[model samples]
Target: MNNIKKSQLFWASCLALLVTSLSFGIRAGILGKLGTDFQLTATELGTITATAFWGFPLAVVIGGFIVDAIGMKRLLVMAFIFHLLGIVLTIFAQGYWTLFISTLLIGIANGTVEAACNPLVATIYPDNKTTKLNHFHLWFPGGIFLGTLIVILFNSIGLSWQIQVAIMIVPTLVYGYLFSKLDFPVTERVASGVSTATMYKSVTSPLFIFMFICMFGTAITELFTGQWIDVLLKNVTDNAILILTLTTGVMVIGRGLAEPIVHRFSPQGVLLISAILAALGLYLLSTLTGNAIYFAAFIFGLGVCYFWPTMLGFVAENIPKSGALGLNLMGGAGMFAVSVYTIFMGGFYDRLILKKLPAGANEADYLSAAPGTEMANLLNEAKNAAGPEVLQATLVIPIILVVAFTGLVIYMKNKKKEALTH
Candidate 1:
């Protein structure tokens, strides 16, 4: 790769990722506002939120399969178009259906960014896939930090949410400009002359299948928890925005410093440690008080920081023949899991209002006393009533991850030894 094209590709990928991350942060910051403005039940709001995830898997899976065939430049152009449409539609959204569709469109755009960039970066830094992938993923948290900070500042200054949404356009335009005239590289699979059949076969291999299944748990553990921050943390602290910012901030730093860790532990070893820390963080988050919550957020951030990138890195490094198809399938599975969990968790929160509330807690009184519209008040009350139990229920995910990854790690170790001996 020429140095100029390489620099252009790297920076453009970062800028694109920043756009996706900024959208996530903005959506998270405005979730409650959307609920209030639309008078939405928690379950309805969840459907809207899940819309993004729904669009992601569909686009990501399709984009991954066709990205090599159509080229990354075309996919980048498609992403820009989808992002533009989604953001404009979202700004004008008036009801659940409109909001859902808009968010779903945006989700597809987000997924395209991943589908295109994952292989782009992998192809660019073939020898250092793990470290460079980690480097690329730092923008996920960095963008979150930037967006969240912007939201906080905008709110402090009495700026509208529409304006906050508009801020994403800046990065969108910058990425588009950077990518406009750059020549693109073929995917590693295409460049290496690996036939499509071989890539498909690799995906069905035992190792690839194992990693695909594991991806679901890791994605759920990381994203499902993040989706709940604004709701759950409200019951625990007044600094919900700060806590969100701080968590992603830690993730930015953790991912930024991942080179040494990846070298020390290897990808599988890192997954094991991340699983353990995530479980600990979730358990701590379920509690009511103390500085431990901050500590828990930090731990949780560290735990999830490398999961998505490292998972992709492992496949790129170990299952090279699987190519873009493997990367897309992994991403699609993760997003699908998050989409399913978002609705399930939302319904769980809604049900908890009746299931766990003190007998005769007076729904009307709760509604009247809480802030915002009726739906918003009801949802907040439900969260306040059941946040801890909901968090407790989520603990099962990471526990399962720890156990699953432990066996995988041991298996990988034995496999490595066998290979060395051969």
Candidate 2:
């Protein structure tokens, strides 16, 4: 790439990173704060999260088509509309339904930002797709680090969560303004002479089907952590700011080191190791307390650091024609899976554990601030309502099932190719 194009790409990556940082950095804190304010049940909290991912399922379809039709310039601008409206509605949202609606808008905006930018990044750094993709994505976690700081600032100053959400507008407008100046690549679906039918044919083949499995696993594993760390810390410490600082700080440490680790393991090998550690960490996280819980979260973060970028890189390498359309579609599918899992998680949390966890004890607060066994009544309630088994199931969904299959696919493909060469 020329000097001018490289510079533009760097700025564009920054724009994408900033927007993503805003979304992830403050999202979990936002959910915890909402639960505190509204007395939301765990199930309700899941619904709130679902709204964000719900946009993922549909937005990719919309973004995939429109990003090409209208161009990323307009689509990128439209992406911010979701965030702006979402923040406004969130500020005014008093009830569960209203909250869901606003969150859905926010989810769509998150989806659009990615849908537009992933393709733009691919076009910008076409040669080094994996490295550029990893570097480009360094911003998502970087944004999370920033968002945590912002959360600390607002909480220390006694600001409302709505105001914290309103901060998203900064990146939104900044990226929207920056995107206005650049040109983005067209979607491969449009550029390739393939119709929807032909595209569908290729995508549904064994390769695409396996890729979908990887995407779903990657999505849920990363999101479940990002969306819940606040809740995990909330259960123990009333100091929300302190908790955000510690958990996010540690996670930042893990992600910051991902680039070097990824080079050593390769994305797939890294994912394999991370998946095993994550499932164990999640189970340990739910069951343990004090140092144990905190330690487990760190382990979980270490495993998750590579999942997102590795999954994206895997698809990009495998599906040459997908461009932004394919990446966004996979991402959308992954998030949609998250939405479904969140509902089940909430239901399990509400129906089984909350009902039994002692009288006059707020379940939302209890889950948000996952207490240790010292809270004997709540502990017994948690034990009776559910057990380590249920928690283990949720954490291992990706590793136990999805990773197992993905491993098989990798093995078989390699063996088949080796035989042909021989």
Local accuracy of candidate 1 as per-residue lDDT tens digits, 108-211: 99999899999999998899999999899899888988888988899899998889998888888888877888899999999999999999999999999999
- What is the lDDT, from 0 to 100, of the residue 283 in candidate 2? 67
lDDT of 1 at 115: 91
* Model 2 whole-model lDDT (C-alpha atoms): 0.68
Instruction: For model 1, state the Cα shift of residue 254 in Å.
Output: 1.0
User: lDDT by residue for model 2 over 110-148, one digit each (tens)?
Assistant: 788777777777666665566666666667766776787
Query: Among all windows of ten consecutive residues in candidate 1, which has the lowest summed lDDT?
Result: 362-371
- How high is the CA lDDT of each candidate model? 0.86, 0.68
Off by over 4 Å in 1: 356-381
